[model samples]
Target: MTLLRDLPLSALRALAAAARTGSLTRAADELGVTPGAVGHQLRQLEDRLGVKLVSREGNGIALTRIAEAALPDIDRGFDALASGLRRLRFERRADTFTIAADPSFSSLWLAPRLDRVRAALGRLDVRIVLSIALDSMLEEGIDLAISYRKSSARDLASADLFTERVIPACAPALIGSRSDRDGAGMLDRLPLLHIDQTMGDDVYPTWGNWFTAAGGQRKNIDHGSRFPLTVLAAQAAISGMGALLASELVLREHFRSGQLIEIAREVPALTIRRRLVWPVDGPKARHAAAVAAALAATAIAEADGPWPTKS
Candidate 1:
């Protein structure tokens, strides 16, 4: 409406503030303006709308029926406006850095290594946004992504974070001794917990894939409890549901806490690597690179450490 454009948001805000508090002085205090300024805005609003928006009810102020009717929506509109402003502030703040990654990676990996991340980017505010899309992280105002594919997009650059090797692991109670881990013999005894989610991925180390690589097969290993996420599969494995094959990074804690033990360390890893990906050209690029470098270096340091359970 032409009338909508003719009215100033400041005047509308003044009305909302005054209407909510029923006191122009309190409204002015909330808005950080003089009470006179607030009164002037109310007059301006009335003149523009050609309606009586306010009236005197004793010593306190009262909004007219029309203004009262619109108060709830007006309050909600102001709330929405404030929320949008906050998002913009987060997106463009010079000292703020935003990164996105998948849920499993965020919880299992980045969360544990947050101290290192904060140390790497001194004085900068760090934000990690999680998304289900593992391959693409180029969302609006997101500076960096811990993503699956190296950017085929020309506008981005990436650094190797880690390529995971699907290590076969299970709860220790599932099998008796370390002596049985020499080959895929455990595959025969324990129920194989299948993570069908990664079966199509380049790094998905399924029993079938492992069989292809390590040369072995079990009758029912191919079809047992199937899970979508590594965490769920890890839990199933801990419950002694079956043998789960996952990357060391994802299951490092389970291994450390002795909840899950590697069935065999001799098993090879897959080539499905993850990278710290970011924009090639933007103000965010340099900071993204610094943070990515720090994360990569810290990852290397951590990955080189000893495995808790025996091989």
Candidate 2:
């Protein structure tokens, strides 16, 4: 067993270079050292090993039988070292910014608006991971998170992006001329879309809650199909499958395109707060700040616009 402490790296490098090139001058040129230095290093290595590793052959050198036997192992060791260094450099230079978000908010709200973020931070790579688990951000190396939590961890920095208001919405074709009826009566005639509490959050809104808020009975609230994701409920509403209770922020595009109509706007709004969260101390903090600023601007823009009203 040879101790690594006995082998100097400089001597090993010189020996390997000289063995491959077969010339002290060429090895020195490759190593950016003088030919005398290369020769001295090779001699030191031979003395340490107690073996004559090279012999003078014409203008160059030839490896001795013992040196030839060791050459393959030395070459392989250097190649592996070089490969490991390259991988480390590549990993550090990737420059990708990752965000964790709720699936519904990502698909309906943030996904469409990401082009604006890209344009604002040109050349910065952005990745959005949609999940119901807010804790996934911390576990998965996410640089930032769009969270519905009222507070964040002590080690994290957070900015209020926007607050969401839950409201009833349905496809324009589902309404017909029934818009003149009372809120509860109109709600009673339509199948009510419900969002299931599959995200492990006990405080999520329900059709019954919306019905109670609108001064209606809970009879029809539990009759419609249930969906795990709010985006799926919104899509169901767009296809005229049923009327869905969704955040105003998520339904803005649907309203603007006339794909869905806001119903029962007179009902009191249920507010849900959203925030942009990131670690307070990390390599990605600066990049997260820029992304948070862009997201904040988009949120403000959305808030300043007029709420869609029925014509």
Return the top candidate by lDDT: 2
Tens-digit lDDT track of model 2 for 1-311: 47575657888898888988999999999999999999998898888879999999999999899999998988888899889987775575457777777777888778888876775455668777754355555555777887776434676788999878878888878776654322556777888888876442446567777777777675645788888887788889999998888788778778888888878766787777778888777777777887889989988986777876556
lDDT of 1 by residue, 195-297 (tens): 7553114444567777667666667656788877778889989998878888777898898898988875555654468778888877767778888988999
Which regions in candidate 1 have their CA more than 4 angstroms from the true location? 1-96, 119-124, 131-136, 196-203, 218-222, 264-266, 269-272
Candidate 2: list runs displaced more than 4 Å.
1-94, 118-123, 176-182, 197-202
lDDT of candidates 1 onward, in order: 0.77, 0.78
TM-score, prediction 2: 0.63
TM-score of each candidate structure, all chains considered together: 0.63, 0.63
> Candidate 2: lDDT of 146?
79
Task: For residue 112, give model 2's deviation from the true position in Å.
Answer: 3.5
